[model samples]
Target: MSPSNGIQTVALAGVGNIGSPLAFEFLENGLTLSILTRDTSKADLKQYAEKGANLVQVDYSSEAQLTQALRGIDVVVSTLPSGSDDQEKNLAKAAKQAGVKLFVKSEWGLDYDAPNMEPVNPMIASKMQLRVELKEVGPPIFVVSNGLFATLAFSSFLGSLDAATRKAVINGNSAQKFSLTAFEDVARFTRLAITRLPIPPAGSSRVLRVQGFAASFDDLIATAEQVGGNKFEVAHKSYESVADKQLEPSLEGLIAWLLASLSDGRGLLPQDKLTHDEVGFKPSVDIRKTVETVLKA
Candidate 1:
């Protein structure tokens, strides 16, 4: 790892799927890591505490609790999911008050920064709004514009693919290029962002557009079929119709909206100028490997 980069203690606001891998990355890098959550009884939270993380439970509604947890933290990262805007706002306030040097926004999906990439629904809108509010409320906001979590497309809940049925579906024409990032790669890139690059302070934010690889859902299906020794029949959906059904709110609804957002090619990262080369993050997994993982699971 590169020498400190002026960051000493790193604190995370939540430790879900994204946060879990990210926290481990920080810890493995020898950075001082703290995990902030409201629940200490969770088995996962307990594991972090065992792994040398300062796992502190706090009531997000209480400013004192938030402030106390943030004291002496150099960077405060929100890995909470999209809906927790209020929690993120409070965390940013606490980070600022505690003199944290940077506040990282919890955006681990999509190139929503791309042109014409409007929010398809309230969830995506909330994520975008949180980034804006964080700029006004916290230290420098660090955003990684990773196009999509590679695992999302293969998830059973997203319903894009069925291993048993050998069938697959996608938003867009199934050939619109978009970036896909693995969770561990996201963590590693994020670690690089904080430790190996110049992070801005409050009033000015930093955005890095990075990806594991760029591929279409068709590419993913091909990869999966190759890895699994089977072929997948494919179907396509439009972004407009898929976005409409997601207003009811469910896992299926959310993925439908996410898939729809990709229809117009807004899902893609700029092919000419991806930030991975500048940031120096060589992804550990690509589309084929990511697909292999999902097919196995």
Candidate 2:
């Protein structure tokens, strides 16, 4: 568990999968939380208000609205998707002007700053570009690079061909090792970092690459087999064969880029110098646990 140093009053930009759970985690930690949404009367956020989050209405497109919404906020945690770089940039600009103490960028996936990376979707590239621009901002921004969400991959999207079938289709080999963090755990870590000190100086733009466990896809398959009480068949498909059919053709290029990244072992997490011992974030969920839960589900 990460310690909170009494800093409260934080804001979240996007409150979807990771952000929704993150808001709950922050509330659990007793932080004075607020969320900026397109609509303030959203029924989804009503429960969050009951949980003690001040849901504020903001026109995500307007700079004045965002700036005014963030007037006295101490920290900002942005979970906006990669395609929303423009919104993130606007938020960064506003946070800087508002004298916010910390801003956590919406970099929950791969480390886009890694050297010699191939081009991804233009939108993703724009997000990386936003990081460089944020460096010029006055407040310190933290970039968290947790590989993949175990919950997401285990869901029907990446795991099975169909939800009902529970048939997992692997592109290449199931033996490729990758680091996976649970969505809930990612939220927990984000809240912990939000209320805590900026471990690495804002000038350096610290990157926290945290993961609960690193395991191969074969490990997940075997675990699924054990939990299902039956041996499951592993179907291997070429990236070319499944790229267009399984994924949208519009996103095929991005899919191939991400697949190549996994094949090259870029999906594996590097040995980060800032661990729980150094900073203070140790996620409790592991890939095996995530796999087990998916199987039971």
Best by TM-score: 1
- Report lDDT per candidate: 0.79, 0.71
Taking all chains together, the TM-score of candidate 1 against the true structure is 0.92
Please, what are the lDDT tens digits per residue for candidate 2 over residues 176-262?
A: 777788888778777766666543465447777777677776777677666667666667767555433322324555555556555
Error of 2 at 146 (Å): 0.9
Clashes of 2: 0
Report residue 233 deviation for candidate 2 (angstroms): 2.2
What RMSD does each model have against the real structure? 2.1, 3.1
The candidate that achieves the highest lDDT relative to the unseen native structure: 1
Pairs in steric clash, model 2: none
lDDT of 1 by residue, 28-108 (tens): 888899888788778868777777998788998877789888999989888887677788889988888888998888877
Error of 1 at 151 (Å): 1.5
Q: Candidate 2: where is the Cα deviation over 4 Å?
A: 1-6, 115-121, 159-163, 199-204, 239-250, 272-274
RMSD of 1: 2.1
